[model samples]
Target: MFRRTFWFTSGVAAGVWATTKVNRKLKQLTPENLAVTAANKAIEAGHRLKDRAVGFALDVRDNMVQREAELGDALGLNAPVADRALPPPRRYAAIENRTGPEHVEGPAHQKNPYNRNEDH
Candidate 1:
């Protein structure tokens, strides 16, 4: 009789413990809790994306250098393409001297006979 009573009490205690654990777990799985977890995951993904983009840019730059070296070998050129600097743009004369007054009297084509868009 004592053993039976002890077993029944143990069973009741275990049932209560299990119920409490399940309720706690259900609360943790609520919408707000889940949303917080999802937001944390999304933040982690964004950080990873930034890191991967930087890595990708570095990889592309390295690949470009390697390809440029290969092209130079194939073409038998010693100097890299980046060595050449473009010439500075030439300065033009005053706008008044080069082109006539801003407001012309006749149609644009009439004033400038050399206009390429002139009707044939």
Candidate 2:
């Protein structure tokens, strides 16, 4: 009876130690922790890319404005034109008449132009 008790106690102690070690290892390899780490990295990268794109767009806009100012100065116009003047209307002759093509009927042209055959 004493030998049996000793063996059972050893087995229980070994099982407890192994369980503690496995639990520690699992804590280091949890899927939730890994997913959080990956998501944070992706968010950080996206923020950096967005900042760079905005800065580049601002630089391009500033360059375009500067170039336009330089061109306006080169042109003798004191101020930019408020609106472009419209050209004179085209003159049409009353005697000249235009004729359109005559319509023709055929068996193949009887199908509806706007109808799609999807229901069939």
Candidate 3:
């Protein structure tokens, strides 16, 4: 009789444990919980991708600066001011600054040929 009672108690305990475990699992699988988990994972992935893109951009900028320096050295673009070549003196036409008002047809605002409205 003691053996049968012990077995029965053991069976009841096992069933209770199983039911509790299943209930916790079901709660975790609910829609709200699942959506929160998915959103968290998506945000984590976006952060990782942004970090990778920023790293790649930094590397490209570093390489670009290095290449520009190399080219500047190859060409004498980085030479001292005294060593640099100068363009020949140019003879420019003298600019006339007249004091009189600029000649315009009708009112200055009305001279806007781009205006499509005749009412203006």
Give me the candidate number with maximum lDDT: 3
User: On lDDT, who's better, 1 or 2?
Assistant: 1
- For residues 1-120, write the lDDT of model 2, one tens digit per residue: 999999999999999999999998888679997888789999999999999999999999999999888887787444646654566998854432224122234674453555333454
* lDDT of the candidates, in the order given: 0.83, 0.77, 0.84
**How should the candidates be ordered by TM-score, best one leading?**
3, 1, 2
Q: Roughly what TM-score does model 3 have, to 2 decimal places?
A: 0.59
What TM-scores do the predictions have?
Answer: 0.51, 0.43, 0.59
RMSD to the true structure for each prediction, in A, is: 10.0, 17.0, 11.1
Candidate 3 C-alpha error for residue 64, in Å: 0.6
RMSD of 2: 17.0
Give the candidates in order of lDDT, highest first.
3, 1, 2
The candidate that wins on TM-score is 3
Output the better candidate (1/3) by lDDT.
Answer: 3
